[model samples]
Target: MEENAISGDDNTHWFHSNGIITSIDNSQKKICVDISQKNSFFDGTNITLNCNKSSLDITYLEAGQEITFYFFENNVLDTEVAIEKLNIVTP
Candidate 1:
């Protein structure tokens, strides 16, 4: 099963969000994503999503890089959530 598939325990579900890399904190291993699209997870415009710890190689990530990230529902706080799966979206 895909990690991003809609499956989870009774507590929460998973969702994917698309956005651009606004900033990166290599020391913290965190990537600040500027959400460009809206879904059930993000409803506001221009929200920055702090994503971290993905199976993908995030070492090569940089600002302006488009990406799709999977995260759990209700795990977001002010638009920030830990990334379960991160995939670079090539143009």
Candidate 2:
């Protein structure tokens, strides 16, 4: 899949978020994502997603799993500020 960058909002300090995978560091409880917009800079590149103290839980999440996340501007605390929800589908 293609990757891209997401611009954050200036007002609420939030930006656009998308679905990605928790590529590496599964043991450390971290989710890596490619927030870059499709066909934008850093496309097809891997971006480290941070998961801070939020209600969203990604413990059961595994590599290659798809997830929707929320983006915020001037917010670098957690790569994944807010996780939309989990999609469980049979493969």
Candidate 3:
């Protein structure tokens, strides 16, 4: 099975959100993402997640970088792993 295909217990279901990074706080380990318009996976919502350590490092993340964040399973605070998942759609 794919890494992303892994499922978790209730209240721990993983969801992926895509948007330009609005702000980042490495000290507190948090990230703020906003999607102005709703899409298939998003609802024009601003998602704020508490980041944690991941298999990939995200220390160099900058604001305005297009990214898709994967919430860690079982953790209320989403973690930003330095995964190579850069998919952009230009319409």
Q: How large is the C-alpha RMSD of every model relative to the true structure?
A: 4.0, 5.6, 6.6
Candidate 1 Cα lDDT to native: 0.68
For all candidates in order, the CA lDDT equals 0.68, 0.48, 0.52
Per-residue lDDT tens digits of candidate 2, residues 1-91?
3422344335353343444574756455467875434433233446556554355466767766655454443444433333333342311
Q: After superposition, which runs of candidate 3 have C-alpha atoms over 4 Å from their true positions?
A: 1-13, 36-44, 54-56, 72-91
Candidate numbers, best TM-score first, in rank order: 1, 3, 2
lDDT winner between candidates 2 and 3: 3
lDDT of 3: 0.52
Ranking by lDDT, best first?
1, 3, 2
Using lDDT as the measure, the top candidate is 1
lDDT of 3 by residue, 1-91 (tens): 1224235664555545566777988876666767544544433466655555454354677777766655544443232332223333221
The stretch of ten residues in a row with the least summed lDDT in candidate 1 is 1-10
For model 2, state the Cα shift of residue 74 in Å: 1.2
Task: Work out the TM-score per prediction.
Answer: 0.71, 0.52, 0.53
